[model samples]
Target: MVPRRRGRRPWHRSRAYRLARTAVLVTVLVTVVRCGHDMPHGGAARAGHAAAARPVPPPRPLPRSPATTLRVPSVDVDAPVVGVRLDSAHQLRTPPLDKPQLVGWYQDGPTPGETGTAIAVGHRDSRTGPAVFAALAQVPRGSRIEAGRADGRTAVYTVDRVRVFDRDDFPDKEVYGPSRRPELRILTCGGLYNRRTGYTSNVVVFAHLTATR
Candidate 1:
């Protein structure tokens, strides 16, 4: 009777609905992003760079020379270093419990200034009293570590990080892995001390060569 409406005036195609949809479409926004690793080409790249944003190169590594002493000023540690090897149980031996003033260096690895990882181990305490690295865990990042070598040169390193690990689950690869740049690892007993079991964890200081004298 109403002039036979065409499919009841299809709601989707009505003028009111079409105007609302067009308004929504106009309000929508789209953004596209692309990431790249390659540097920009030509002089345009140089013009956009600021002096402060320029990256500085790392220091060059020094020649091999056994470490003779170790110093950590932040914790007031200055101890003579002596060569130490793995014990019968295949563990890197610590300095003699009796000579708490001494630091033990892992002789199998590169010297402090050399282009590889070097290690120094000391006791955190002994039955007598506090030992060489007693406050090693307190050392903060950016602290200076100096290693006196046999060549009468000092290999200066800046502390990067300090961490404590349970002795049973120590990470061998991450802690002692091969490194192309000069590196030093300082270790001492840490965590809880048990009357029967001694220390439950190990404190390690990671550092890298930064200067020499």
Candidate 2:
């Protein structure tokens, strides 16, 4: 008989090869488990992706009406309130100063005499001196705010409270929320003035409609 040549067994019948393959398979499974936490369908990964994909709702609309005039008898603020358009830049337009006191309405928001929070902004001081709203900080709760509209209607509001806020932390919701009773928000710069940072805070007066005159 011819001498048989030595040769390797087929993989399915090799004990050493089977052990090596099992080792490699275990290593690969371990690596996948270690990194699976960060995979897109993993628990933490799914939460992160959902949060990033969520949409933010748009801001609510302001009330609407004809142009109106605002008057605060306690602070001696009487001016023709002109509508400040809501521009793409999202800025509150400054009213023209025919006199020292002119209140500008944020056109994007609720109009005076409407059942919602209406914003009226004015300059705290002019180049000459303290302008309209110079005494805004002194306005107390229970004070009256009046708005006279060109459509032959008048709305009266009572001061509810006043607050100061850093521009960075402006309470946009509370200051601009909808109301069953007409509301008013008076905004102006107050607090310490920083040469580099501009005004440190904003003075806001909150008032609720008391009556229509």
Best by lDDT: 1
Q: What overall lDDT goes with each candidate model?
A: 0.65, 0.56
Candidate 1 root-mean-square deviation in Å: 27.3
- For candidate 1, write residues 85-188 as lDDT tens digits: 65443345556656888988877667878877677877666557788888999999999999999999999999999998775666655566667788888876
In every candidate, how many clashes are there? 0, 4
Cand. 1 TM to true fold = 0.73
Cα lDDT tens digits for candidate 2, 64-148: 5654788888878888877765333323445554344677776655566676666677766655677777788888779888888
Question: What's the residue-level lDDT of 52 in candidate 1?
Answer: 44
Consecutive 10-residue window with the lowest summed lDDT within model 2: 30-39
* CA lDDT for candidate 1: 0.65
Candidate 2 — which pairs collide? 62-109, 62-110, 63-110, 63-111
Once superposed on the true structure, which residue ranges of model 1 sit more than 4 Å away at CA?
A: 1-54
Error in Å for residue 182 of model 1: 0.7
